[model samples]
Target: MASEWVVAKKCLYLHLPLALTSGGSFLYMEQYIVSARKYRPSTFASVVGQQALTGTLKNAIATDRLAHAYLFCGSRGVGKTSCARIFAKTINCTARTPQGEACNQCDSCRQFNENRSMNIIELDAASNNGVDDIRQLVDQVMVPPSVGRYRVFIIDEVHMLSQSAFNAFLKTLEEPPSYVVFILATTEKHKIIPTILSRCQIYDFNRISIADMVKHMQAVAANEGIETEPAALNVIARKADGAMRDALSIFDQVAASSRGKITYQATIENLNVLDQSYYNRLVDAFVAQDVATSLLIYKEIREKGFDSQFFINGLGLYLRDLMVAANPATLTLLEATDDVRQQMAERAAKLHPTFLYKAMSLCNDADFNFRQASNKQFLIELTLIKLCQLLSPSPDESGSDEGQMRPLESFTTSSPAPHPIDIPAPQPAPAAAPTKAPTPAAPAAVHAPVQPVAPPPAATAYSLGGLSLRSRGASAAKAPTEPSPAAPAPVELHRSKPYSDADVERAWGTVRRSFPAEPMLTGIIEAAVPARKDGDSFELAVGTPMQADIVGKQLATINRTLRNLLENDSVELTVAVCEGEIPPAFWTDAQVLDHIVANHPAVGQLINKYKLRLD
Candidate 1:
């Protein structure tokens, strides 16, 4: 075996200058190469995402426990071939280190580096996988290294070998020449013969994590003098789906097209990937139960050329990532930059886990049915509507057994405060007109009714749309008669405590449902998210100025109902085009510093003294 190997080596490198030179002075210029090939790992430590396998291989070499045959199995682009090459090179290093890594300084290492080494052999089993090919490989195993300690044979895509090929090579693989070592690599291990598997040591490689991929891409970009945002790198990393080579390829494409810097927008554009902003806005709409906005966002996505199924899948993944980011223990599973993670955490903070789970289930179901449905657009729209509904408050609590039943009309929602059902019936006014207050005797008359009106529960407020059932004379609305001048004074009705944002939304939704005459307005109100800026001053975000004007016209009516339900007379409303956010182009800065400075006296004085132009 050793004599044959020496003879092959002597013939292999008998010619030098692996690089072709003209006139023995000028070398041929290397053509442009992709980053994936340029940055291929030459050492185990340099291999991108297989620490366990690499570590085990090094330890085996260090302990002098070399296996006769080894199998490297994993998905494509996961460094299987790279690891095999590195292992073969390390074993043949003439001056190997104590840590069991190649020195790359000896004659054997130099020949391998120049791709002229006869000791290390590589075969592409994917192409040459017939019985004849296997017979030839078996014959070659008899040879040993010329200067190195052993002969290494690396057969990549070994699963492609035919049954006959397997049978032909089985004996040689099971018991190779004493100076020979064999390495088999495949993306599919089950396809390989069981007899072959039994003889080789198997190393399973894992998909490279997004965090590792991002760090590696960052290093490559830095070395290439390309400036890339962490967010952009993270996007490319996630798109690579846990393959370092794929990530590098994507990074190369984006860097080439982007203008000097690789921004997140540039990557999304280049990859044709849906922007994260869309998902962010979609989640916002879901939380608000804004069906109109959700539908519109989906339409926008469609207009952008994204497939419905793709959108559904992306939404499912986005929710999954948000779910992972929501918990500290699972946050490590989120594949994003700290900035993106923080944004996701903020969004997640607003969502209950139940809502997130249900939202994900809706998206998954939509994805499952997307291809089967004839009208994919409607299917997706319906799915989004259902998702919005999951976060919406029920119009009436009558569905629940806990809520007492009453005649629907017996509950009056015509006014801000609930009206007495016992009052004499009267013809109703037009829907646009304000409801009139009942006469003074209405309260006394209410005490005479045999029907019931339940008192409000603690920490709970009931809307007039849903009946508050109570039996007549069940409670004392009667003037206390000075508390009978004996027992302690009667308990006053509980005052309304300040409500949180959730409470405000719930109350507002009920109020909207109460006005069944204006279905469109009710929907608009449902879509708008109301936020409290100061005591009693709530800002409601609308999609358009027209919506703002419409809501503005109802400002008095809405404030009255909200104040009555919330029991805060100071309750106020401000309808604006959402969170004071607008397109930057709209301002174009002639929005005017004086507009802001008018509120700040000190800043106004400074501006006036400087004679600064408003523009």
Candidate 2:
């Protein structure tokens, strides 16, 4: 049945023209033009995008300030070679032309256009990257141009040249003959050595803009008599990513597939590209924290033969675009259509900055580890799950009353209210001290009635100076019942001498010595300074909030030890986050080692021998 259909289709096509002619009718048949050939830029003005680079070159030519060695650096298909060829022709053309354009009518220009110009030399360094090739090129450079005044050598993919080959060509590149001009083009500038880079006048070409590419595509479509949707052309332009050659290739594929009538759907289908709607759905799923839906979408794409890596990469790029749209300063960098941009901006506004940062980080990490992962699909799924988690508030940030509620042990029952009490009463003296010192009870008896009993003050309610129990509410609280004579009154432990600076310093020394040898713990202690002494309490100033938190956890134990040594039950500790100089002695072992390695060459050598990493 298939063979029969093929024969019937062929017969109909073969006889249709004959049948039409026999009826005495003349129907004009449009000429067929491939998109790549039809859309090729014919003039400097016709080149899509790259206006700045092209304009600069033209102006330079007009001013007669041509460099002997030129290096064109950019990605593929941005017209590096085409520009070089045009520049070469414009320079050698004998005929006078406006705007420094090549006169195609001139003998030199005609020869170049016909590919028969002896003065112009073109080499693909990719296939000819060897010492012998460079030697041969040097030999050719020794000869003068047969027709044009200057001989031009255009080498594409010059970075492909081997190290030896690059070295061989260096002398000639740096000091070419008066009549010889060299133009080297490369997509990978980093691969080229500094010596080679220094020898050439570098011209970095930018990726063509989507607007310029679309406009150029429209012109090509008009000239070819092909009806096309603006939206379709825009999609083609984006898929090209600022490369005119890629855009033309996509254009050709779409034009053929759509039979000269291109629409957005047809272009996307022919390109085997995921539609914008897919990206939209993926983003929606991500925002909604629908991990299943995200995974399903990924699976569908994978089932459709799209590469996992490509899909992941595209998703990352899409996320990057959305991130850019979220910020006004970076919105201009988004290359999507106006409708897509608006959608992105709306979605970006809904996303929290922290969530966006986390999602981007996850995607980047997944991308980096994708190739090395054993289960690539699972890796992507995991990344999507992580991204979904970003949409939901973290457990620590959910504001759940239960999560914030402390255990019974952590709660203080001294307060009348349901909230935990924050009373900072002095620790009772040990049993042995009570038997030894009966005089200690005298101060307590004297001050106990005078010092009114009051509710523990909230840290927020009280100022740093001190909380005044007497002034806040002396009349509201009921008096405490007198204790039995057997239960001795609490001793009002006091220092005969107020805490001196030396005492505080000694306390700091004891606290510092008590810290565990762990690097992280030591680091916190080192950054903290003894700010001041208030009665029995010592105030510690930490360098950062993080350091303050670290020391705050250990404050109770530290205070107990300090108070025990001082024989003062009223001893207390306070930590305040402050900005101050980090002491030199605070350096962790790793920091000290790094400092030594960075400053002393001998230490660096020793470090390298041990293959050590700083903690």
Question: What are the RMSD figures for all models against the true structure?
Answer: 21.0, 18.6
The segments of candidate 1 whose C-alpha lies over 4 angstroms from its true place after superposition are: 1-30, 337-339, 394-615
> Which digits, one per residue and each the tens of the lDDT, describe model 2 over residues 1-615?
565455555656776432222222322244444466555655577666788888988888888898999999999989898888888888898874787788888898889878898888899999999999989999999998888788999999999999899889999998999999999999999988999888889999988878778878888888777899877988898989888888988888888778879898898888877777777788777766577998999888989898887887788777788789988888879885666577789877655454556667788898899889999999999888776655332321211112111110111011111221234244553433211111112221221222211222222232323422112211121112122233323244454445554555555555554433222333445434444454665565433343344455456545544554555557666665433333446644533443343345465443323222232
Tens-digit per-residue lDDT, 103-159, candidate 1: 888888788888898988888998999999888887788776678888899998998
lDDT of each: 0.67, 0.64
For all candidates, the clash counts are 6, 0
Candidate 2 overall Cα lDDT vs. reference?
0.64
Off by over 4 Å in 2: 1-38, 163-168, 289-312, 337-339, 365-386, 395-615
| Position 219, candidate 1: lDDT | 85
TM-score of each: 0.63, 0.56
